[model samples]
Target: METFKKGTQRLTDNEVDQLMKRQPHLLKQSYDQIPNLTPNSQEVISRQATINVGTIGHVAHGKSTLVRSVSTINTVRFRQERVRNITIRLGYANAKIFKCPKCPEPQCYQSFSSEKESNAQCELCKEVMTLVRHISFVDCPGHDILMSTMLTGAAVMDCALLIVAANMPCPQPQTQEHLVALVITKLKYVIVIQNKVDIIFRDQQAALRNYEEITRFIKGTIAEDSPIIPVSAQLKYNIDCVLQQICNFFPIPDRQLQVPPKMIIIRSFDVNKPGEKPENLHGGVVGGSILQGILSVGDEVEIRPGRQSKNGNQTTWHPITTRVVSLYAEQNELVYAVPGGLIGVGLLIDPSLTRNDNLVGCVLGFPKQLPELYRELEINYYLMVSVVGAQQQDGKTQKIAKIQQDEMLKFNVLSNETPGRVIEVREDKIMRVALNNPVCTGLQEKVAFSRRLSNKFRLIGWGIITDGKTITL
Candidate 1:
């Protein structure tokens, strides 16, 4: 390492002032900031590992239950209930776990329900021991209404955990759709979870039949050879075995100087404080796992747009200066953050610097390229088209249109969601996507599109733009 001269040993006060020019909210006193760390300090403290995980399957398949059963959150709706309460249950939960929050008195009070049990149980040590050091689950919405959310969540996953009911052997029609969404993300690692094993205890033959059918359905799919662990999320049987397999299959990546300092903005928002200075419009905070890299205060960063370019074209990007005013890893703050851990960064920039009304999804890091846009793409899709529709080309009105179930299509990529014609229809494999308009794309960038149907945005498929060349409509 090179040494700095006496004059350059420290950054000037004006230099920091200039850096915080755009994001003054990050300078707040309460913001938990990560100070610069020495090389040795970064090596001593073991950073928690971060793995993006998503569940794919049909509705009511216990996709959400599996997550709630293992995380800090609990869906009270799923708990055994009486009809007297008359509460409609809509169960969906999302949670994050860091090295458990070490607290002396970790219990929070709860209201009495039936004039008894007035005290809230200690939530701290309750499942603290079960907390996976560096893993968090992206609780996915299972019903048809939430397929888009599921698909987007899967795009960022390092691995996909597919849950199949042990009682329901064959893949449901919706199961095929979920699989197609997973394929769009281009995620390679997958684990098939054979859930509700208790159903098979009474009827051995039925269980065996279901197993064979399920195996046959996924024989050539992404999870073909993945270990299928028979589990009961309700009964809590073989849960440890599932966790062990996950740990063994998806071991955490090492966190050291080797990793880069990067963070993806999965969530961003603004807040208001009473009796505060009016001039202080705090820059929004972005949250996501540090894919690779170290982040500290006073670093120059970039916020890249998530829009796809029209046609295959390269776009230029620039970096913005933002101080690490505050940092939270699994809800706890560290002096200096490390990689492989989930972090929420308080960026030092104007609130308007972000887009989409502060919606989370855009990525943040060192910006160099304009991220790229593409028009033409080749995708391997699972088309669940009806038999009648599949025979002819009058599919302009159907959900998946005139296509065979489990068929793949090549579709053109576009910026806004607009209806387009089929450029070229090919047999089961590679098909050319002829977009009605132009879109930009860069080499190796993954892009996704879906059908604009009435019920839901049925997932089409995602593919990397091969040739970064622009195409005119």
Candidate 2:
């Protein structure tokens, strides 16, 4: 038995270790009786079932503000985004919905509360209850020139929140384009967020008119059935209702971890600090979502279309092999990564090779498990009835011209965008395209096609990759 002096005495480290070893049952008992003090400790542990929801709308339409409202971590990474007040690249944030113990109603709790209070009591009831769910928000840029970035963000989303500002007229240019993209991406789950209600809080008639216009515009679109929730993300008004709708609509998709691990690299960077010792420096980190299977730490991985190399008169892409040193989901360190949400993978590779997002658009997977690299792709595409987001005369949809042979086009697959030329147009609507840069993609993968109309690449349509090959031309 260990005895202490009447006043107080501190045990030496060796003595403490000896006591713990001799009375291991004491330690076991202490461990077994440990209480879960986390406020939502009783909540269903479904962290692995993370749902990805994307924000798409016109520029200055509160896409970033909406994400900032709900997310615990700042999704905006670049200083330029803060300065310019527009998302230049894809931004991600993790958020949770918690239920109030005192309130039986669904929307009686906070929706956009800070994550620092994750384990704190409910603000309204002051009682702790299990959190309802967790979701990842993908903030897509609304700028016209960044349409390709928006399309890529839409690809990985299970659901979308199409934001429309109430102060502005309904169906802003990007709003229409984003809705079209939802249809092209085959996204069935959607919620239309009519944000900035506070801007028109005093103007009831104007707010009603804007709402009606927005409803009319979305009538024939794919989002026709989506619920329109009026919110004030800036003022944190009606955010709870938005969260309730999301919970009801966006359920987790079935993921198969039995298949080979594969991930699309959306953003990559060298994370080493300046003046850090070379021996202590960490490797570069690749951030994106896993499409399928599981990637565990220390797993050997290969990145395809890895680095550009000049082979005589032609350019070639060689696969790069590296080991995953660490894995992270949101801000939490993860031992293994699974499908359904975004992840960050730390790799044991040369930092210089991954700096400045050089590895962006590359595909990561086990050796020989990635799809074929293609310089030429055959796609069966369909043109939209009207050119989306384009200025139309008389407020009517305008007919777009069919793709012509030998015409230059832009192809977007996953996050990779490449310039290509139409080589062959088939009667069955299949068009063969020769890309200027090679891409790592699989058959049946959805690809968005754009045309240089009026000197800008406007999204025309999307198609599945049917065939790919190395073209000599």
Candidate 3:
């Protein structure tokens, strides 16, 4: 122990030592391991689809059961006590687009056949199936209290699958919260899965009526016109329909970009074992969905949090390596993963050096576009009607400057949320905003612009920030 202690003392300075004392759970790396990117000649890149599905509603609503049914994997069973211990779990499944080989007519298999035999025969010579690899789905928890978790999963999603129990037609409190979150995330594509339909199957007419009532409630919401697929996870009824719907909703994505490395770190943790060498502790494991470009092992990346630097510098950047010891998509290993997919990358850094929330609003890239700073940005938002004057701990409502259309607001934007001033209002509807400080933002970046009224901050609405410069509205 003494020898180990002395060895560890050499790796981290007194500052890190003092920090680890308070957060003992972070003592993953003992003394020598920190991530370092080594240059390599072999680079493997793959194209994969990134799908995020959230199980939302009250407790015991079968959110977990629904995800387990679709993915055939049970995350809750493994760690029931800690559902959202990490921001998200990475899941992979196979997706394919087969060309009808047996079709008497060309391209007869374009539409999926209802019958199994006909589908297998392809109605043609022989169907050619392309194994679309790297389709990832993020199974999110649905508790109202776990809003943070839901939002995290919602942040990077192609679509959402909102699961609700059929017996309970009225949207639960958590369901409402999930709806709000989906709106805030600006996720347009969503499919409502009314699970546990067995309970209501006896009363089909009542069940249909209840379903219609719920649909009416969701009118004008993000789930507008979203097909409500009813299924009994326990009985496996309509499971195939759910699968087909997913494929139809989200087709295999095509390769879009080839330059720059854009990686989003989703999960990070320290792997610590008893009586183990401190250096063996697996350091920071940052995982994210790469939106564009490709990242390879031994690539040098700059980790930039959205916040400004302490020096008052508008931009901050950190160099880290692709010390990825293990890279998995969904649950399969890959030599290299590309954008358009979800992947959990194991970094070779001391997990203690970083925190999960730190990477929430961060971006990783090469020297090019290292520090992204934006001055003026235009955004579309929705007002939170319930976000009226909020009382503070002192029982006084916080003061919020009156925002007018065409006016520019000044404030800060962090982790997809904007807390800024109301500069100008235009046409009584649109308002312009100027951030107190600049952040690394981009076009179509989902942001929750908030305003402080009285003692509480209220979310105005969620939208993408377009045009980094000044906006007219």
Off by over 4 Å in 3: 1-50, 54-60, 77-134, 183-186, 220-222, 306-325, 355-358, 370-381, 386-439, 450-459, 463-473
Span of ten consecutive residues with least summed lDDT in model 2:
36-45
A best-first ranking of the candidates according to their lDDT comes to 2, 3, 1
Model 3 reaches what TM-score against the true structure?
0.65
Q: What is the lDDT, from 0 to 100, of the residue 214 in candidate 3?
A: 73
lDDT (Cα atoms) of all candidates against the true structure: 0.51, 0.77, 0.52
- Report the Cα RMSD per candidate: 10.0, 8.5, 12.3
> What TM-score would every model get versus the actual structure?
0.62, 0.86, 0.65
Query: Can you tell me which runs of candidate 1 are displaced by over 4 Å?
Result: 1-47, 74-133, 167-169, 198-204, 253-262, 271-282, 306-321, 335-341, 350-357, 367-441, 467-473
The model with the greatest TM-score is: 2
Write model 1 residue lDDT over 1-473, tens digit each, in one string.
12211111233556445434633433332212223332223221223235656667766677666765655344334334222221122222333222223443112211111111112233445433323334556555556655555654554466767888888746775577677766666667778888887977898888778778778977898778888877788786676566656656765544444333545555565544556586866666766666555565544566544323334585332335455566554443433455543456777765545543343444555544224434455544344443111122553524445543343332323112323444554575444565543343346556565654444456544555555334422
- Which tens-of-lDDT digit does each residue in 155-197 have in candidate 2? 6788999999999998898899988888888888889999999
How would you encode candidate 3's per-residue C-alpha lDDT over 268-312 as one tens digit per residue?
Answer: 545455577875666566666776655544444566543234446
CA shift at 133, candidate 3, in angstroms?
Answer: 6.9
